[model samples]
Target: MEKLLQTVRITINDKLYVKDPESSDLGKRIIRESIKMIYEIGFESFTFKKLGTRIGSNESSIYRYFENKHKLLLYLASWYWGWLEYQLVFATNSIPDARLKLQSAIEIMTQPTEIDTAFTHIDEVMLNKIVINEYSKSYLTKEVDQENKEGYFVIYKRLVNRMSTMIKEVKPSYPYPSSLASCLLEGALHQYFLMDHFNSLTDCSIKNTPTAYFKHLVFNALND
Candidate 1:
């Protein structure tokens, strides 16, 4: 029989939640089920009341972990970017070539996700779907400026900074490392989103074995 995976704690910005969900079984359930529900029914239709029903917990319990559904969304997105950063570091750790490191990062960013066993309660692959489709909603709101001031986006910025550094290493004089890196992150997401919703907006076939169009776009920009 396969051994049960050990629980893994994923830390996010404390500012995103009223309580630490990974600290208890109930909290973990809240995060795990919330991701699944958000992916099932987009954020607009997701509610703590519904999540409460699915998890067999009361809505107040869910609220204790997160102030509202919006905060929960931010928490989920932060965890994903942090997780992606971890993937990028692990994939590029042994690579010495700057270009190869950047390429690895791009591949991880665009590739379809598989469940990460570390966080057993959360379905990372489905969480990734939520990230791709609902990520923009995390920050595009009236309170974005306040959230930004509170470092709500640090994890995302750090991931972008990591890639920006790699791009700079490849072309030291490149004046747009950050811009190029952010474009690769946001552009790939938008492409995937388009492929899922408005098929006409993007020609990228995410189902294809090799997710290379993103690499093609980024490498060309860097090569120019």
Candidate 2:
């Protein structure tokens, strides 16, 4: 009995060591690699087979981690949302003054990370198609039921709420509504990046560096 227990303990320790040199490393690697592939190929063109090949794993192995492609996409989107939350929290942390917090929040929204530019034009085309198709299907399926509405809201609305809260904190006499502020911010970004009119309006120069234009818009909006 004593020999059996010793052998079992040794086997467990060996398994643990082999499985993770540090905890959560394997999962992090999976996510990181998955994001890289998704950004390169876009979600529509990105297959689990390709992802598995890139990550040096089998399709079955990825399936063990994620039930399906849709689930994997959701996971990626959720991870992005979490990243946005972290940025917001970090930006607001040092700004005890509400105005500064608001400025930082706008800055966070306008500034695209290095990860953003890693995607090629082809990647953007494929990804936009995939997202639009998914969203259309979800709308048709009435997937925007009450519970899921909150989830959608959290994706973008929460950022607006944070900004609104900051505005209220800074200028108690002139409080901004969260919904209105969110609409303006979303409109500005969507108009600049996704709208066709932007090309003709800005002589194509602003299109080259949309992030900078986005930051300018945010600053202008705040000043207005």
Number of the top-ranking candidate, with lDDT as the measure: 1
Best by TM-score: 1
The local distance difference test score of model 2 is 0.51
Error of 2 at 180 (Å): 3.3
Query: For residues 145-205, what per-residue lDDT tens digits would candidate 1 score against the true structure?
Result: 9999999999999989998999898889888989988988898788778788888767777
State the weakest 10-residue window (summed lDDT) of model 2. 9-18
TM-score of 1: 0.93
- lDDT by residue for model 2 over 129-208, one digit each (tens)? 33323333322334447525546335545556766777667555553456545754554445444434445655324345
Q: Which stretches of candidate 1 lie over 4 Å from their true place?
A: 1-8, 207-210
Total clashes for model 2? 0
